[model samples]
Target: MKSFYIKIKSFFHSIEDNIAFYPALLSFLGFNFAMLMLYLEDKGISAFVIEHAPPLVINNADTAKTLLSFLTGGIISIMVFSFSMVMVLLNQASSNFSPRVLPGLISKRNHQYVLGMYLATILYNTFTLVGINPKETDKYQLPGFSVLIGIALTVLCFFSFLYFIHSISKSIQVNSILEGIYSKAKTRMIRLIEKEKKESPSFPDTSDWKEYGSKETGYLQTFAAANLINICKENDLQLKIIPIPGAFVLKEIPIIKASKAIDKELVEEILSNFNFAQGEIVDDNYALAFKQITEIGIKAMSPGINDPGTAINTIDYLTELFAIRLQKNDDTIITNEDKSLIYINTINFSELMYQVMVSYRTYCKHDMTCVQKLFIMIKYLLLQQTNNDHYHNSLISEAKYLYDDATANVENEEDKRRIEQLYKSLPNKRE
Candidate 1:
């Protein structure tokens, strides 16, 4: 029974995701028109007279037959038109009105297609109703009470359709699905590339290394990290063994005590495990060698948003001295979930970097610092990471500048004060 229920749920979910099944606005209008036609015929209204009489003129039908015909025709038209208009509004809401709405459904291109389909459906229904009406039929006119009720029912249907559409739009979560699909596709592509790398030659005879960079913060880093993980796993190699395929070290630093480093190397040899590229080698009392390598690793990991040169410079800074600062605090790497979220954040940052680059090109005067920080916050949110003091500060600074300039969403004093306080506490400089 459980299995059957799961299958049923899955079936429904599949149906819901299928855009073709929804049939756009046109399909709903067509269905409503058909139903309206059925209702008219059931009420003993002759189609021939309905076709001959002008739709707007209600008083012309004197005979009972003519009146009944007119009443059904009018009601049907009203119902179909009413239903169609509600559908148009609902479709627009789904496509535009709010970010919370089904924005994924309504691209400008799709909007045009949907509008055209709806108009075609409306016209087809209108023509069908007009063409099928009777030229001459003895008609028992619908009484005033029946006509009034019909009009009320039409109004009810209009509102009812709108309500149903609104409910569906709320429940659908189109944007989430779109985002998830995009993420998954990109993830899979990264996996595929890593798989190829694993299947190919390793180290000395390395394959062509393609550079991926975008102004977006996390984009390239997330992809690179994921690929690296996959490659290591496929080759049955730990990261400690290979580190990154391409990491350039600008400086050296202390990693561990000489005694510990010597012991670690001895243990590796005894175990016949050659994972370590180099153990911590303590030379001068000042620094350790492996520490320098680790710092280099972190530098290699730093994603350069939108510029390779920027990335190279970031790596240069992550040398042993500053790399210590880059080390994830125990609090930062609390769980596997946290790591996964970080990866996502990294991806978002990359995208933001790209967006910032585009915005810079378009609007030369926009503040880079403000744009960068806003996107950095956006990345943090995407990653499901805590809005730590650093992010909060950056956001506050940006918000204040925007507010001061009478920018968007900065309305009053309370907001300004809040922004000021946040900026006051958060660090102004980035590592």
Candidate 2:
């Protein structure tokens, strides 16, 4: 039963991540609200409004029908245009930047809400239009107040359209995208740092721990951490996640190490808590942001694009991220208050730094601007707060790699001179 519950929760999370969730939900709300207005209309809401304020009610059946029909058509047109704009946005982002960014943009709640509002407005007006009759003898039964509401909703949508345009334009800008990614990555990192300081613990030797293979094959994206914690606490077992978040896992591969051998049923329940999917979502995994930023930098440096400015911006964000990372320990350990339950062996700081710096050294080494920025970025990280010598050594090592690339590939005498001077200026012990 717990396994079934986990699957249900997992399914709901996937549904919630989809772009259509909000639109479909708001559409249902719109339908229900239309029925509600009809109920109020049956209760003589139009008569009450007419008695108090005559101008607020729409008594003429032809006027109500015409207005609702016209607004409904107009809303449909607006929705069509909005969807087209979104498609174009996705295409440009995927082609020019990186395809990974599309998930972030697609899962944007604001855009979803705007599109949902458009759908809701359309459905509300269309349903209200169904009930209007020219030959109804009673003016109070005309759904006059309801027609007024649809008109008001249309006016609100006009404003929403304006907001949507402003927001979408800003979202498409590369700076905004970078900042958003940076902010999210920083938040996730900071949370980890706090956890390390407070609840972290040294675990007993796991060399003898029983290894368990995954039953499914896909990229391990989100781990249901809260649910896993409950299961661990209740079962009095410790779990170690083998592959880091954002890693592709295969069936019958050892992806978890349990403190003891467990029954098949328990193993299935534990594995069900891990969500595997095709792509990465940045929110659950900060590593994806690092990867996304790196990919954007690589795309910019590609010959077809030849846009060095974007690459420089990406370097700036990565520099700040790395600096924050210096404050992190080499390992990530999540535990309950008693300092026992979960041990997540994440990609260590050294490995993450090596991966990111190697990519920059590979792709951006030819561009003097980008390579020089890499030199300075390494210099800045070397000065940040860290308790580990290995992390410091990693930065120094990355600097040496950048220097070697700059020396071999950089052709301009002046740029080579600058690289020489920059390499000389590194922190003395780091040499």
lDDT of 2 by residue, 216-237 (tens): 9998877777778877887888
Each model's lDDT: 0.33, 0.86
Question: Top TM-score: which candidate number?
Answer: 2
Ten-residue segment with the worst summed lDDT in candidate 2?
A: 1-10
For model 1, residues 1-431, the per-residue Cα lDDT tens digits are: 54345445544433332234444555566556556654665565543334565352232234333444454455456446644654665565434323222322332233333333444344433433442334433333322222333344444444544554554454334333333223333444344434433333222211222211111111011122333333334343322211121122112221111111233443232122111211111111012222232222223233432332322332232222222211221121101211211111112222322332333223321333333343343333333333234433333344344333433334556655654454344444222
Cα-based TM-score, every candidate: 0.27, 0.95
Poorly placed runs, candidate 1 (over 4 Å): 1-25, 28-135, 140-425, 428-431
lDDT of 2: 0.86
Q: Candidate 2: where is the Cα deviation over 4 Å?
A: 1-14, 429-431
For model 2 the TM-score comes to 0.95
